[model samples]
Target: MAQIGMEQIGVVERVWRYPIKSVGGESLRQADVDERGLVGDRVYAVRDARGKLGSGKNSRRFTRMDGLLHLSSRLLSDADEPVLLDVDGTAVPDANGFLRSYLNQDDVELAREGEISHFDELPVSVLTTATLDWVRAAVPDVPVDERRFRPNLLVRTPPGCPPFLEDGWPGRAARIGNVRLTFVRSCVRCVMVNADQPTLPHSSDVLRTIAAGHDNCLGTLATVAAPGAITVGDTVALESQDAL
Candidate 1:
């Protein structure tokens, strides 16, 4: 095996957690890292009668349901009571009722019965500011906020590094403070990225740009190799440089 060198790639710029699937996320200054991901991330999910998790990826109950993105969910009362806030920043007392009314579906239910997360792919989603900028340049007309991509950790890549460089990072391991993460696979782009978080409108150009530029993939899914606390400004280092 060729010997690899260790270098400071970047610092954790931001952290986010989505307590409920298909709902808005809460930004954080620090988070407890675990095998499942940042604690409380995707800990709950809205379920349909058929038990399908509510996700924009579902394309059945959640497609064109960008309205869910406009509402932010945060743990307020307790783990059992995640408060959903509206665009106006008003607290929603009845989460299921508000969701039912907004989704216009009566068969859906909020569930948090077990420890298993409702993640669509792997536990952790990692993105770099360099890649975010690349997507913005690819589709200048469309707004590209990290929220649209729903990444758990956003790293600011080293200066002068090329964009979308993480596309080649699958199977690599990243070390952030006491945590170690193994990059599992490239995250596939979907229509969810095209949905505007503020206006909840769908724009085809976002996904189109990713498809044309990077084969409909950006970011990466990762699993925890070692768990610890991760904070903003923590230095990130790639521990392994294996083939993608």
Candidate 2:
């Protein structure tokens, strides 16, 4: 039965998990939600000699390594073994060996998540179609996609939902299918959103369009309050704490 105070904000349009960071992500019809967002998400990442992780942008925790976006990884088993793939979708036999050649660097290892979490801020990132609509209206000449935002959960709002609807979700809770999430804050995007993926051309205009009016924040971030499972077409119902 639906709760009296719950508001149905949207339906889950898509689910994604990037087994390897800064690389292409795998989409699924359903996914298991856990404390780390998704069961196999970001469990593996390419690391360099200096101990910085591979990413499209350079930072203390990440090193700007070109061509990482041209690659992706898929968890082959429950053990969390990742199968590296090229942009053409061919799986590489030797993961590390392929990384050396593809990235043109040595001392690179496809390492697993250590004590420090691989996520940029929160465990999960969420985006709504309403926000994408805003981006489309802002820069109709360029392309704007949820893949560019790299959200773990993509919510599909109704036709008239305003843009950035998730902005007001902080300090609130939402039930997405069997999973429960606590909204943390708006996701502050970085240069990685502008990186080229398999079919996406590299373009600065996407991020530029966001920064000009939205303070470089696009989606929202959250933590799994009740770990479970979610599927495409699942209803996302919000529970406002302030009203409770």
Winning model by TM-score: 2
Residue 117 C-alpha lDDT in model 2: 89
Which is the leading candidate under lDDT?
A: 2
Give model 2's TM-score versus the native structure.
0.96
Residue-level lDDT tens digits of model 2 in 112-142: 8999888889889899999988987987776
In order, what lDDT does every prediction score?
0.80, 0.87
Please give each candidate's TM-score.
Answer: 0.89, 0.96
Weakest lDDT window of 10 consecutive positions for candidate 2: 72-81
Give the alpha carbon lDDT tens digit for every residue of 1-244 in model 1.
Answer: 2226544678999999888877888888888998778888877777777767776665543434446777788875355657778878788888788878878999776788375547777999999999998877877777677987899999998778898767767778877888988888999988888776775356798888889888899899999989999999988877655422
